[model samples]
Target: MATSKLHVAMYPWFAFGHFIPFLHLSNKLAQRGLKVSYLLPKGALPKLQQLNHHPHLVQFFPLVIPHVDGLPPGAETASDVPFPLHDLLISAMDKTKDQVETILGNLKPDIVFFDFGRWIPSLTRRLGSMSIYYSVVNACSMAFSMVPAKGLTLETTLDEQIQPPPGYPSTTVIIKRDEAPHIVLVNDPPRAASFCLRLTAILKESDAIALRTCNEIEGPFCDYIAQQYSKPVLLTGPVLPETSATQLEEKWDKWLNKFEAGSVAYCAFGSQITLQKEQFQEIILGFELSGSPFLVALTPPHGYSTIEEALPEGFKERVGDRGWVHGGWVPQTLILEHPSVGCFVSHCGFGSMWESLVSDCQIVLIPFLPDQVMGARLMVQELKVAIEVERGVDWIIGKESLSKSINLVMDKESELGNSVRNNHVKFKSIFSSKDWQDEKIGTFVQDLQFILESGK
Candidate 1:
């Protein structure tokens, strides 16, 4: 008789950032001979179902929740509804608890891996399955935000402020001017880190804690997290599918054939986050002034009439055939892999950064809001793999600065461009190789298997 495969379920937040990592994790587990099921709201089923052809790997289980007051009717995913982040987190917690309970009652899994969403612990407890907390972001960011090296309590008066601890090299401090309205204030004593720290503490009692990062990039930070928590830390390198260079080449050849070598700049923000009309127009003008062939993925403005209406007067005619504007969705991985695509002007989202790195493309960082600024800082300051645009608090770059920056990056002999390309080559050598596969993702599976088999 064959040994029973461990059943694992993953619950990710509805946003693409959360969903993409969860999909990678599930695919990894399915490849390891475990029975993996990914749970999302019914409306999100289509995207997962599209990827369901993966051989013998994973299953998609979409759960439909009845429309509740305050939530939009027929809202299938978190992205479908336009609630504030705090409100979305709260509603997802409430809805997931009931939905996860129903699913687990029908087919109990040995373990459940969940993104660090609110109410995950309570739901996992109710389901009677061992739970693992997966942090999809960088461990440094997670640790710094959640748990400071020195124990310090945040004052309620400055609830939105994040001051750097004494002796940190960076001069900037993060501040949140606005609150998300839905979350309540708890006056409890400072415990582990933030919610994620609390979740890690709980996982210590349950099974294990896993993070989606690699030792190659986040070694020191990953070590700190492990030593502090006294738990087995698993570092799964940027969880992306392994595709051949030939495959990428084939898909991107047609797109790249139109442009000169090392000429076109690829631009995209992550899936979530939209820009207003004013900011959008500034970007268009910046690209126009650069005098380079460009491919920009246009997202709908947060509150605009249409994309065409948002553009500046006669902007479309000037660029004409030199520019490509793709709405809805484009084959991003394929586009990035193209040889003619030399530079990336990005929102500095982590997934996009990983894709840019793997594609060995030079990057021009243009971060809008949230953790993106930090990601941009890391790439430009820490890794020296990208150039940051000198923009204001509103992320508006003047046409002159934008044009200068673009020329600086696109110039083949320019020091900045050459440095970016060199670092791109180094990052590609480290991350895109097959040798690190075992140490990166294989160890994660081994640890997961141990937990499932031990049945502790």
Candidate 2:
């Protein structure tokens, strides 16, 4: 008798940070000959259409996102909505429970992996489908935020919250209370309350939990989560493509080809965080001061129109051909893999971090948001593979400090620079080892098969 292949459904939070990782996992499952159904907001389909090249076993379902009271019309994904209006989008997503249920009925998947869907586990349980809560963040953050659930709520003081969770050493990945959103610390506001309630529900109802990280990177925390939840916690091996170096566009190829090998600094902040005019100038000037050829891609803040408007006076003429400041988009992965690229200046988003880890590039991390700070700490403090640009007491990083960080990462012979480069090389070997990735992901798949077969 031919064994039946399990069918799986995936529902990720509306943000690209979450959506892209989920898509990668779906592709991997499909490649392994399992039927995979991916649920995406209608507005997000175009982006996926560009990346997904018609995998045979993966099906894409584009669902309309209903408008909520405060969210603007047609604002479907997190990128489309402003930060303040994010709660409205979450509310709108909750309204899709009926749509999700209708689709699940038709798909009849054996299991569903979900992010930020409180009702999904109960719904899947009632329908005889197993539910797995999928976290896209690193396990250390999950250990702090998701493990106790109550530790992050209103009663925990700023001082108390900064301490590492119990069983962890005091020095391990401690997050400052102010680094996170106020709602994350206090539970009063409706959005915060809603978030807490949903997290509580998902933890109670889900059959298992999964993270897009490896045991190598977060083994202790992964073990902690399994014991705390009394359920299987699977590690998905970062779900990174073997190589991010796709074909380069001609314009970049022409410019990048002129630079000497390992002489260029590439800077990009992923789509979410927007930089103010002053912060943008500091980065540009810092690059100029480092005396390295550089290319940067930035998205303007809400009102700004172009890079020129944001740049300081004479900025272009001063650096002339040595620098490139592009406003909207740049081919980041291609640039990172380019021979001339020596260093990556990044916001430390997990996607970018994974991309940098795979490349030979050294790292200069300047994290902008709360979660980004945790990721930066992981790289600079925990992993020791990246150097962080130091901010002053006011939490403002000046051009001098930024330039120093750049120089340190780019310098081939400096003690600090050599240490960072050596650590990065060690990580690259581990990240690139086919044997390691195969073992981790293969174990996860075997576990899933066991779950499916046992259910039958």
Candidate 3:
């Protein structure tokens, strides 16, 4: 079959950060008249169905998440559990292999796109389908840590992990601390080891590798990946998000309207990251210290059931009406597009990274995960389009440091801030160009056609 007429099925790790981008790519493919089967848990269906603009071309295939030993009843995705319980959820996903096989056998898609499912390639190959390791993380991160040349293994030390893999393109991204971020948090060597091993294994096994990036920003890194893995690295461009007709919620819109244009700071750390109480409070205090009217959306802090209950003493009274904190979903894209939001304080997750770039906001990054840290560095060092909030002793983010970073970008006249602001404007123009994104998507389809015909 011609690639244009091909059907592609996607199965990402059970995290919004992962699957949401999968859906975005599906939307891109659907626009080109390609059919897509998005396989995800039944719980994620309602939300994703709403986001499915091309219902006829893009269909949702729901799967049952089998109950794991320790997980709370009905816990499905990463959002339903804390970080420590993630491995159990992955186990549950593994148990669904029979279900996945049955679905694919019936659907028989031409190509399968997956991340974190190491068995997917073998399974798809048995079914005579091509499997692409569709990664939503930045290429630099994978190239640095998980590339074949790195020789990383379960026994790799923190010292070795900090070093760049042989022939990695950039020196900007590194594990600056004595311990990896996960070590500081989870401290479970086996889980971390299996994660690294499984990810690299999938890279080695997949028919091709795909990323939601254009060559403009990460070309060299992508090249490094292709060379190291000895596989075709497909670029889907930025897959700039499809515009949503949904308006920003009335409450947030009305509050943001109170601030002047280019005056408010917006802080959010995507879905998966649940910060400690100390860190969460410090971040809120950081915004207060910045003295900029701010809106912060975050998950509930550790040991706290609600964000309001987690606040430091007298916090609401001290900040007065200048600040608001919500522990639920907010329309991030619309908020970024709002004129009042001048600074975007983000975790540098891949999805948020693109959103920040395309929006007219000064970027401030606070990254904890390896991929996020690398992405933050890419923006801060390579692109010079953003600043990272500095971490002090033992990877602790100080409120003053966060305040300083925000103020640096918000202050309009600061030399460093001006440079980043100008750079952001330049890149934003390039990224937001519809013709350019569409062209990459076109090339992407052609590449798929070549792969399907030639079976490389």
For all candidates in order, the CA lDDT equals 0.67, 0.78, 0.86
Q: Which parts of model 1 have CA positions greater than 4 angstroms off? A: 1-4, 53-55, 83-89, 122-128, 148-207, 244-256, 451-456
Candidate 1 per-residue lDDT, tens place, 199-232, comes to: 4445445355677778767787778777766667
| Angstrom error at residue 312, model 1 | 1.0
Q: Provide the lDDT at 41 for model 3.
A: 93
Alpha-carbon RMSD, each predicted model: 5.8, 4.6, 4.3
**Which regions of candidate 2 fall more than 4 Å away from where they truly are?**
1-4, 155-197, 242-245, 454-456
Q: Which scores better on TM-score, 2 or 3?
A: 3
Clashing pairs in 3: none
Best of the two (2, 3) by lDDT: 3
What TM-score would you give candidate 1 relative to the actual structure? 0.83
Q: Alpha-carbon error at 82 in model 2, in Å? A: 0.8
**Candidate 3 off by > 4 Å:** 1-3, 158-186
Q: What local lDDT score does residue 433 receive in model 2, on the 0 to 100 scale?
A: 85
Worst 10 residues of 3 by lDDT: 177-186
TM-score rank, highest first? 3, 2, 1
List the candidate numbers ranked by lDDT, top first.
Answer: 3, 2, 1
